[model samples]
Target: MANSLVSIQILPKTKNGENVIPYVDEAINVIHQSGLTYQVNPLETTIEGELGQIFSIITEMNERMIEMGSSNVISQIKVLYQPSGITMAELTEKYR
Candidate 1:
């Protein structure tokens, strides 16, 4: 079972005040390419994986924004970790 859940909302400042949807898409690509289980909500994305991997992906996403010419990036994140191990489904299935 996965031991952690991470949700991230990334806002990258666009050079020349360009639209940010494309940059956001690129950030999402970092998570998508990570090979971890994930869900994309309207405001953010939740990824299931080890804690280290999730943090790494967050750093990579921010770096990618820099590479894309973003002057700055802000990431809002939420994390839950269980050493005994927990899962996304286990937590949310009650509502589902």
Candidate 2:
């Protein structure tokens, strides 16, 4: 199966103190619970996995953040599927 790349940008209600970090942590926790491998970037998060799992995890994270008091959560995604697996084009085609 090809891996899809996920980029998620999370902004909390506040930029300073533990406010944002807590929400970030909560979001990360959602990713972890999703059973997918991911990396945290400076202003974004990257997750690589199956298309379904990737989308599911991102949605879960966004919902979790909202439950944590985040008014707005934005997500961007890119999947790099290999020919042997599912290709990015295929994933997009399926979703689109």
Candidate 3:
């Protein structure tokens, strides 16, 4: 079981005031390549994994945004860590 759940919303400033969707999609692609369990919501993406790995993924996302011509990147992150282990499904199961 994973020890952390991280939700991240990345806002990347476009260099030419272009649409940001492409940048966001690239950031999400970084997450997809990580092979970790994740859920993509409208405003943010939630990733479940070790805390360190999640943070590393966030770093990669930012780097990717910059590589994609973002002048600046803002990441809003929320973390839920349980050493005993937790999962998104476990947390939201009741609602489902």
**TM-score per candidate, chains pooled:** 0.95, 0.67, 0.98
lDDT assessment of candidate 2: 0.69
User: Which segments of candidate 3 are over 4 A away from where they belong?
Assistant: none
Q: Which scores better on TM-score, 1 or 3?
A: 3
- Encode model 3's per-residue lDDT on 1-96: one tens digit a residue: 999999999999998789999998889899999999999999999999999999999999999898888889999999999999999999999999
The residue-level lDDT of candidate 1 at 68 comes to: 97
Better of 2 and 3 by lDDT: 3
Model 1 per-residue lDDT at 43: 98
* Model with the higher TM-score, candidate 2 or 3: 3
- What lDDT score belongs to each candidate, Candidate 1 first? 0.94, 0.69, 0.95
- Would you list the clashing residue pairs of candidate 3? none
What C-alpha lDDT does candidate 1 achieve relative to the native structure?
0.94
Which is the leading candidate under lDDT? Answer: 3
Sequence-dependent TM-score of model 2: 0.67
**Per-residue error at 29 for model 3, in Å?**
0.6
Model 2 ranges with Cα > 4 A deviation: 14-18, 78-96
Name the lDDT value of residue 11 in candidate 1: 95
